[model samples]
Target: MKYLTIFSLLAFITLFSSSCDNDFNINDDWADITVVYGLLDPAADTNWIRVQRAYLGEAAASASYGEPDSVYYDTTAISVYLEAYSRGADGSLGTPVNTIFLKPDFTSRKLDDGIYSTDDFRLYRTTETIEEDKTYKLVVEKSNAKHPEASSITEIVGIQQSSNSGFRFVLPNPNVIAARTFNGNLKWYQSDQAEIYEVDVYFYYKEVNRQTGAVEHLVQKLDYTTIEGAQIPADPFETIDVDGSPNNIYTLLASNLPELKPNTLRFFKSFTVIIWAGGEDLAKYIDLNRPTEGVNNSKPEFPDIENGTGLFSSRTSIMLDEVAMSQQMATTYYLSSTLCEKGFAIVTSGDTCYCERIPGIGPERVCD
Candidate 1:
């Protein structure tokens, strides 16, 4: 069986540029495909929709995309809007609670070897929160005669709460940096309707100004090296266990902190863990993107948008905030030998660090 190509199939719910327009066109193609991509998260403060047209023609001989107009759309030719609706008692659609007009925003990114270019894109965004239990519809209209208007619907999924749903740090002595190494378990209950889960931890710290005694509580979001691409099981009682080790947490912090100025000493604050649960649409999209094991290597069909391409899905997130650090973590990890070698000023304390004793005082510096 030949693989059915869906534009933006590999980009998840976001438009990460699917390569439908290669320079060389080996096959004859005359159809202009309308591609749309968006993922709705109720926890987010804003949402964005990306629209693009698939180009089919003889590929250019040169590597360069000669002109900007070849890829992007004329802003005046496109119109986008998002309509929100709440469900009724009988499971029917109610009147739209709000209608948001999306504005056109052009963005660009730098590629490898200093190559700068803009994508064939017209993005529409709104600063409205997509609350749980409400359904959303995205409508895209175009002035072009050939491309038909498109629409997609997504029902926002609520989060599943767990009684003991948080990361439990296993620092035997919170005061020692060496012992402060992570030896704990991050746990969360599975959502019955969610197929995917993402676990993220943000490390909080403080950066103080030496001259004026000003302070800033900086946060470092830790990327999961081992906890990525995790899925929630069908059994809701099965808790997801993210094995946390000292190396897992500290290695990430050490690599990211040096950029903040290795020479400057910063005190470690608390950490927060964020858990995200994805809706059914997200699960279908994930399964469709996976490589087939057969000789055909064909992709599965998983488009949710009606009269267009790509997914419109919902996700909910919960954050465990203001988590405190143990004493061992403060003395060792905060001002450890590794950090000291990198020019972080040595902090002198009288039994307890000044920040801990006074609460939110930040890091203590030399001569203060």
Candidate 2:
């Protein structure tokens, strides 16, 4: 599965270019810099890592980026693997568990057209199940003796649980009424080894074709919030809340939903919440790479991988589905002046209320 951390590699290139002045040399001696990017997740059946070399020459870096040979190393030139270690009760690494070797994966997924070479793109992957109770160390070995090996270690983000109650919505439930005025809170049990958290809220609905009588289910996502530098609590039962305002949901729907169509009828359904937690190394990497402001904009480099200029971390996600809306909130979609014109309909207690405009009358609300 594709992970969001993959974009960090692109951001790294952008940041490097912006930091360079016009006087900087474009044709400097090539440095044997290996770029490593990986995110381990215990929930995934497989994990993949991207390993590439930084190139420099007479040509502009952008010009060479699209060339397969310029950015990618031959498959046989490098070896990648992970060494598992037992994590002790005191949070210290114990004896080695097992080593998992990764093979170059050319299929499974395709690369999008970009500045990077998409023709020969590849990723190293392993199907071995990742365990949450252990720590994983990534090791990248190069056949070229001149380049040093790149390595980094990370612990899984969340603890293993039998139930799906690890993450939950604490406020604005039973129905999200007056979302603009509703204070929202998303709570989750403190996940082990998690340093940063991100929450996403999705609004689901159905659109019926006025002519064909066919229905299409659709969903719109709103990035609720991100919580950084979170500390694991002493009590496992203790929870952490990510603050948010539901009013944004209304605004998001109003702005993003397609323009009202005369041949379409829209009905609001339910909401889903997804939470993501990142390991300490991943959190630190993001923190260090964030855009700087003010007169002094210089930032320190954050290459968590040893003998390389990239990151190897861990992340996991949890989802809560089908959170129902309150009856009043459902009614508001059809009655509210701001949303009624958007062709919203409400269905509650076996009754349906559709808001629409009549040619002779100004506007009309019909119930069936």
What does the lDDT read for residue 158 in candidate 2? 57
Residues 1-368 of candidate 1 have per-residue lDDT tens digits of 23334444545434434444345547775654557778876667777777765555466523445444554557777688888888798978778998878877656323343332355444767777666657788887778878777888877755533333422222222335444333334665554345576667787778766556677777778765322244444455566777675556666766776465422446666677677777778867877787778788777576676666777777667666666554555455544433433323326554322222223653332334
TM-scores of the candidates in the order shown: 0.60, 0.78
Top candidate when judged by lDDT against the true structure: 2
**lDDT, candidate 2, 228-277, per-residue tens:** 75344555566776554445566667777778766777887778777888
Q: What C-alpha lDDT do the candidate models reach, one value each?
A: 0.61, 0.76
- Model 2, 179: alpha-carbon shift in Å? 19
lDDT of 2 at 211: 88
For candidate 1, which ten residues in a row score worst on lDDT?
164-173
Show pairs that collide, candidate 2.
Answer: 175-325, 175-326, 179-247, 180-247
